[model samples]
Target chain A: MTKISAEGICKSFAGPRQRVEAVRSFSLDVREGEFVCLVGPSGCGKSTFLRIVAGLMEATSGRLEIHRDAEDGRPLNSMVFQEYAVFPWKTVSENVAFGLAMRNVPRKERDARTAEWIDRVGLRRFAHHYPHQLSGGMRQRVGIARALANDPEILLMDEPLGALDAQTRTVLQEELLRIWQSRRKTVMYVTHSIEEAVLLGDRVVLMTAHPGTNKAEFTVPLERPRTLQTTTDPQFSRLSYQIWEELRDEVQRSMEENA
Target chain B: MSSGGQRNRTREEDGKAHTGAGLMSPAAGTVLLRWVALFVLFNGAMTVLRLWEPLWWAAALVNFVLLVRIAEQGALLVPARFARTYERSLAVAFPLVLLAGWQLVVGAEILSPTWFPPPTRIVRALWELATGFDEFTGTSLFGRPWEIPARLAEDGLKDGAAAFTAESHLFATLMRVFAGFAIGAVPGVLLGMVMGVSRTVRAMVDATLSAFYVLPKIAIFPIMMLVFPNPFGEGPKIAVVAISAFFLVAINTMVGVRDIEPVYLEAGRNYGATGRRMFRHVIIPAALPVIFGGLRIALGTALIVIIAIEFVRSRTGVGYLTFYYWEILSPDKMYAGLVVVMILGVGLTTGLKALERVVMPWRRDPGRSDPGG
Candidate 1:
């Protein structure tokens, strides 16, 4: 049940000063419903990697595939972006129902499905509210609900909770865990936070800058129903510290290069 | 920025400190007191000069309270306490404080007020204009003296001004502004939306419009006159308003579209929306506030064009009426016509402001309770 495989992927960006290799020789295989985390320094191609898998951008050179066999007929992967991307004018219900609306779902069913998902994200109160009225965390929940509404087999999230506060971030993380448990879609979550990677990810892909590529992957041995309290456990700390050590040098190197 | 036509900007900025619940500060108190004193002084002088009634004081007081309320809310008030702006000493007040001062100068033979008569004369002139539709009734059919209003009156409008009713010269001029606005604004909105979404289109438009935008459109008046027929009537005037407004709205819409975050576009794409779907659901709503901003700017520009065109040559619009009075050198009627033009302009702007509230109710500027006025 392979959800997606990116074999020998690479990404490069052209800058005014010079050509920058943001990712190179990055390879990974995610199983169906496996929650994978791409953790790295700021300039590392975690987002680039996620984008390639989501079919938003083509990798410089790689083989990418989705499990076409799954009768879902929804796309191989869909993404929930960071920042406030919810269409401001549409109600929360419309945003959640966007994919089905695109597919021309009958108005009644779209309403029902949208209501269900809106309630799933605990935004039932704000189902008719515009995104501008909602807080940043609430807006992010809209983004999450929008992504999940499609029932895509694979969901790619790029620093989805980075813009939120500590309290909101933890709440959303638990929400993500609960949602992931129920639906079990393959997820590639990108982040600069090591703690986030440890808490939510099943396999953390620690990446580095300067020809960004996978440095190592650690399988989280800890159990879920995971929370911020889980981050205090010795196992979570050991894994996070290891990932930090892998990212430490690359981050400093990136800062110097950027400066 | 709009040519200091309004003398008081800080009046509102100062008033902001003394809202419904706030402790009205020292500076706020001084401004309010000054306004009140000015209202009293202006009316007191007028009362003294005209052998004016005690009722004038009540009117002046009501105006003052409303004026303070308007200044407090940073909004304009109808029945504005204009007299309150002159509340210093009646003896030393400026010439045009309440038109009483102007009347005194004219009556006392200090200066010929034929150039700037008192407001009472202007009000008298307005009353005359309303009744005597015989003399100043807007002439129709250009070459002939066909009375458009008389014909309308023969049909109906027992009480309404015949010549000023719909299908008359005044209504005709209004229709031109609206028709031209729609012509320009519709194209402006569509083209602007396209340009806003695409960098290539935006770049193309920016280069072209910036050139024409800076070239004062008045310069084109001569060129347009030569190209069209002798009568600058509805055709050239409408074209002028449309183009003037078109650029403002188009550019604003472009900015609105261009300014939308990449995130929203991607969200649309992620949901399987492409091309028209993306534009319809994603870009348009995202760009509405900016588009409306353009529309507002275009409306003001359209009015400006209407005035300038009539000033150049015409009969019947408020602008044309002003020019006719100016030609006859009747300052009272000319000032009266100018007041009419001002009322129309204010009415149009206020109408569009109300429209903006209805159309894009979600549009908001950050931290402000209201979206915009």
Candidate 2:
């Protein structure tokens, strides 16, 4: 089934002296249980595209739909925002249970689900701690737990591991794949890292910067449980190198558009 | 503390050839030089006091030498083997300096004891006033207590509560201050929160309050008395105290709201938190420390207004007693009543500080209080 479909989505940011077209006539579709990552240079509007899918922002002229079971359940889409977006005032457990509470989940059920996810993320020891008390890596764990506790059909992630240390990022990347394998949820991940895209995604969607439109889409032959060993493999480098060639010419266009 | 200390250490390390553990150390000479200078200043003041013996000089020298020993270890002011902070050094040094300066003025006899009321004299007066329970009781400093239809000592006062009792007077004054403070503070806090949050309310309300706050509450008291019912029956002078506290709280609440950080609000936005949740969880906690600060200022202002109002016309409390003493021109009694007022100020300030510690335990800049603030 098509978990989510985006049809010719167009978006622009209106400035005082000019209208800056960010994404123009962009379109894509993600099948249920598929992992997709969008990658580009700095100004690619990759985050904007993910935000549109999350229903955080509206497209100027396009149709985006989430196909879910309409009779008995409503589809939920949760976003893991870039950096430390976890609520500072809430404990790890409380932050993870935020969506559940919003849906008026019973106190007992919320705690039970939050505890299960906290243990899943290896943050059982830090469950009572506030977000400010945790490091960047721990906070991201809380964010993941918060999103998964809602049991959403679609997870929209905007550079979730971007602020973490090198080691923490590597660890979280594997953890994310492990999470996806167990849950089999459709995810639209945005990032600037090419290796991350090749390793985690089933399909990599590359976006051009100026009036950001689809540049090219590549399917990674690399399979599940992909790790650093995959990066050393010849196929991984060939796919990553091919993506870089298209990205380098488009990066220049992005800079000119920004100027 | 970690970030702030790390920042300082970075600057220090950049300046020196040292790195890491060595960078935590200060220059021995710098610490020694400060220690010697402080000891000299303390001794210099003691010389004027004419109370320093050879023993004090010896102790001062020993203190200087011990300070130099620690300074040499590159651990100056890190609190000796006892794990003490440099705060002690500052605390001891400041009071000693003030006393030294005070002793010089008093020793020179530049002013008469009567007019000057030196620290020694105030201490003596306080002691004598405390001991003379009978002579000090049952009368105003001027000569008599309040005119009471029945003895107030018999009614509600516990044993040893007061030197003398006037039924109508003391209750009237206590009730007035309490009632006025409550009447003003409640609305003041509510209005303050509203105005603090809303641009519309703030624009409309701020002008009127700023104008009211600027006016000396005492100056407006006469006009207010003319407009309202004085009644003169005397349960409490509630009007006088209310006007004082209301304006003070309102002014503070406005300032406290403005002091909150914008980043906190941005953090709340992603959670889809708005309206009441935003206020309950974010804005109020952020403004709490500052609002408590305003309450401290208001408490003092409330007392001042009470005194000024009671002095104009009222039957009870220390303010009326002060007026009665001044009318007779008994300087000693006037001084005694004035002493009571000073004690009240000190008590209020101390109480507020203690209250802040209790109510805002989260606010104690953890870096400062946790072993190394």
Candidate 3:
């Protein structure tokens, strides 16, 4: 079953003098419960594409469709932004319950769901604390819980762990895997990290630099419930290295062109 | 505190080492000799001015400032044994020293006591103003809060007689400030929120608001008087204050709204927040920190405008009392009225700060530990 499909999608940004094409001729089909990671260099429009899918932005020229079986009293998609975009003014529990509260969920049910998500994210102790009081990784956990508590049909994550330290990133990667293993919702994850793509995604979709379009796609033949230790596995290293080899040229070329 | 003392001791030791070396550092030696020369010059000038008599007070004031500067330098040159205690006491001691100097100079009869009354005279006038009612001026400080119970007992809280118990200049000024602040600030915040959220409204009003914002609110007093039927009544006074507060709060609110991070707004939209819900939950909370900043500024502006207006027109406010004392040639009572104004300013600001804490529970002052649940 196709959860999301984009055909000949294009996005262009108009500046003062020139209209720069951000993404051109982009097309992809995402399966119902598959986790697809879009791996690309900076300025490849991976985040632009995700925003278009999440309806935060409109595609300049394309037919993007999200097919749903029936209304499940949940939104079509919820986004986990790169910057941990959680409200600093709200407490951890309030941030997690934001979506439910916006949907006008009953107070008792919202509190229960908020508590459940906070507990799942291992932030029970800090539930009443503000985002400024928490670490960067803890703040991102609030962002994740905020999205998950919405019970959306699909989750759109754009470099959600990019801002965290390496140690915190590894910890969150394992937590994300364990959570996804239990839930298995369709996720479109965008990242610059080849290892993160390989470690998290069931299918990795590669994109080109400048006027970004689909370059290559690979399927991960890994076991379920992958842990942080999975990154040290022979196959995981080979797959990550292979993807990096494909990406290294584009990354250098993009950097040179940008400079 | 100990660390500060240790640092000062090291500095003094360094200074001593430089002096101990027969070749004293030219700069340090010059500074020490200069202060010593200033100390001698100040005393010599004070003695010479005392002999001269009439113009001696002016010379004494100059010498006193020089003495204070020399003392400050001397204090800094030495290592502090208890730096924190010394620093705390300096605040109280410095003012007391100034007061004593003032009393000594006035007692010497160098200047007329009429124009320059001593601290003792000011204290006596302040005490009288606080406790007694003036039959001639028909005004009092605090409406004599001490007499409120007595008045209540006599009048039995009937026929508005109890109101007379607390009808002082301080109360009058406080009432105008609060009434005007409330009248102007509420709608100012609402308009500001509207202007903040809507580009069209902001564009329409931005120029007009900015133009009026820079204009001195007191400049429009005559217009305010014309707007009200009773020109001599409270309407015009409060109107000026309200106008000032309105502009400050509205401008601040607009800026606060405009300054909200786009990411927060996007998150709110993505989470399905729309219209009133978005405003209440996301927009309000996001802009609250800045809005509070604006409110504090608006409050200060309110006090300034009210005092200025009272000085110009009113007969009942603290500002009027200060002017009234000046007209009657009572400098001591004038200073006493100024003290009341200072007290009012501090009290009102403290009240607003308390309100800010209640309204914004999420905000934490740096270095203050959170009393966590």
Candidate 4:
């Protein structure tokens, strides 16, 4: 079953001097329970495309649809922002339970689900602590737990681990794989890291620089239940390097254009 | 303090070889010589201070300047044991030194006692005013907190509260600040929210709001009086304070709303939050830090406006007491009233800070200085 279908979606911003095209003719069809990674350099509008799918932004011209898959009437999609957009004013459990509260879930049920997600994120100890009290990695965990607790049909992540340190990023990547393997919600993950793209995505969708068009797609041949040790596998490095080879030019082009 | 002593010990050890080589090296020896000269000048000034001559005053002035310069350099050289407490030590020390200087100058009769009564005289007057009720004016400095129970016993709770309020200038000022702040802040926040969310409303009111914001609130007092049925009643006085608080809160709340990160709003919308839910869970909480910041400023403004109003037109309040003392040529009592105002300001501010802690529990660290906290 197709979870999300996007055809010729475009996004443009009006600048003081000219109309800047952020994303142009972007198209993708994501399958239910499939993990798809949109890989690109900075300013490539992979995030913009994700926002469009999440209905946070409107596509200039296209047909975009998200199939509602939850029997319990959950939201269509929930996005984990790149900046760990957890409310600094709310406790960890409160942030996790926010969507449930908004959905008018009962107090007992909301607390139960919130507690469950908090434990899953390994933030049970810091459940009553505010976002400001948590580290960057822990705060991002709260952001992830928040989206997951919402019980959305599709999980849209925009570089969720992008701000974290390399060591923390690897740990979270394993945690993410562990959670996704168990739940298998339709996921559209946007990132600039090719290694991350190959390590996580069942299908890696490469985006170009300048106007952010669909450049290429690589289907990962790696099996599920991937771990930190999986990155050391010869196949993993080979896939990562191959994708890097494809992405190297666009990365250089973006840097040059920015310069 | 320990670090300062340690630094001094290290300096002494390091400078042992460099001592008494003043003209040759012009380094540590020169600093030592400068300190010696500073001490000599200070002692010389102290000797001159005993003289009853105008020429000695010039020498004293020069000595004071030299002492100030050396003290500034000495402060720079001393290392702090506890950074926060060390800085606060200077704040405490400067005021104490100023008070001592005032005491000396007035005691020595260099300044007239009528014009500038010494700190001791002010404290004494403050104590007398606090303890004794004036039969002529029917007021006491503090409403005599010690006598509150006795008054309550004699007059029942209702009359006791009224009597206590009537007797206390500080209480009167505080009541005005609280009433006016509430009257203004609630509507100010509402209007600000409306303006923040709607472009049409913002465009319409922005100019007029800015104009009113710039206008001195005191200038509108006559108009406030006209609007109220009784000009000399509490209504006009409160109206002036409310107007001042209103402009400050409205402007600050508007800015707070406008400054909220769009990402949070987007996230809120994505998670199925709409209308009241969005305002409660997202918008209001997001803007709270800024709104509280505005409230703090509004609080200070309310105190200032209320005091000014009291000075011009009221029979009660700390401001009126100060002006009344001034009218009767009692500078010490006037100083006591000024002290009362400071105490009230501090007390109100502390209350606001406590309220902030309750409202904003997520701000774990009270001070914003420590990013790591």
Best by TM-score: 4
TM-score of model 3 (CA atoms): 0.85
Model 2 DockQ reads: 0.16
Which regions of candidate 3 are displaced past 4 Å? A256-258, B1-116, B153-158, B365-373
* Reference-based TM-score of each model: 0.80, 0.70, 0.85, 0.88
Model 1 residue B338 distance off true place after TM-score fit, in angstroms: 2.1
Model 1 chain B — which ten-residue stretch has the worst lDDT? B364-373
Q: Give the residue spans of candidate 2 off by over 4 A.
A: A8-25, A40-52, A56-61, A70-75, A210-213, A249-259, B1-84, B124-153, B156-228, B231-373
| Backbone collisions counted per model | 3, 3, 0, 0
Candidate 1 per-residue C-alpha lDDT over A88-197 given as tens digits, one digit per residue, 9 for 90 to 100: 88878888899888878789977888888899988887787777778888888998998888777788999999988888888888888888878878899999898899
On residues A1-259, what C-alpha lDDT tens digit does candidate 3 reach at each position?
A: 9999999999999988999999999999999999999999999999999999999899999999999875757889999999769998888999999999998889999999999999999889888888888788888999999999998999999999999889889888988999999999999999999999999999999999877998889999888778888888999999988888888888888999899
Alpha-carbon local distance difference test for all models: 0.75, 0.71, 0.86, 0.86
Model 4 stretches with alpha carbons more than 4 Å out:
B1-46, B49-84, B145-157, B366-373
Q: State the fraction of real interface contacts model 2 keeps.
A: 0.02
Model 4, A130-214: lDDT tens per residue? Answer: 8877788888999999999998889999999999999889888988999999999899999989889888999999999978999
Cα error of candidate 3 at position A51, Å: 2.0
Model 2 chain B, poorest ten-residue lDDT window?
B364-373
Candidate 2, residue B130: Cα displacement in angstroms equals 6.7
TM-score of model number 4: 0.88
Q: What tens digits encode model 3's per-residue C-alpha lDDT throughout B1-373?
A: 6895696477567766776574335544466677679767766875776653665656666766666655555555444586666567777877787788778778877666777888899889899888888787677877777766787787777733546633688888988999999899999999999999999999999999999999999999999999999998999999888989999999999999998998899899999999998898889989998888888888888888898898899878888888889998889999888888888888888999899888887887443234221
